[model samples]
Target: MARDLEFGDFTPAEKRRITALTARMVLPRANLTRLRRQVEDIEQQAERRKKK
Candidate 1:
């Protein structure tokens, strides 16, 4: 089963700082469409329980 995400674990200021840093560090260089495709592939493989 997929683990639940815990956004509540971070304080507001920490969350804001993380958000800003992630935007600056990750968003500019991220390939979102390719990431989406990789996620879909993983989901499909998990559904089928295909071993790597």
Candidate 2:
């Protein structure tokens, strides 16, 4: 079975890499505002979890 991984499980470097890849997922001409909003949402969740 595949292991379930959470965002917090990654090292700082890995997290950065993940963010870079996520951004590149959109086409060069695609709408970026939507993607940025989604990424920000996930980041906020990570921050909230860290505070708990």
Candidate 3:
């Protein structure tokens, strides 16, 4: 089954790759904003779980 991704799931190199890809995109600004928000949400969720 497919699973949701958490921020901690990505390695530092992977995170850099994601950022690079996101930055090189020619998509609409709203779409890029949404992607950033999604990443923030994933990180937040991971942080909450880690605190438990």
Tens digits of lDDT, candidate 1, 1-52? 1133245544466456546554654577887666555544444445444333
- The predicted structure with the larger TM-score, 1 or 2, is 2
The Cα local distance difference test for each model comes to: 0.50, 0.61, 0.58
Tell me the tens digit of each residue's lDDT in model 3 across 1-52.
0155554666576567557656755655547666666666655555555556
Rank candidates, TM-score, best first.
Answer: 2, 3, 1
Q: TM-score of each candidate?
A: 0.41, 0.51, 0.45
Candidate 2 per-residue C-alpha lDDT over 9-42 given as tens digits, one digit per residue, 9 for 90 to 100:
5558657855775767677875677666666655
For model 2, the run of ten residues with the poorest summed lDDT:
1-10
In candidate 3, which residue ranges exceed 4 Å CA deviation? 1-30
Which candidate has the top score in lDDT?
2
RMSD values, in order shown: 9.9, 9.2, 8.0
Better of 1 and 3 by lDDT: 3
Q: Which residues of candidate 1, in runs, are more than 4 Å off?
A: 1-26, 50-52
Segments of candidate 2 deviating more than 4 angstroms: 1-26
Number of clashing pairs, model 1? 0
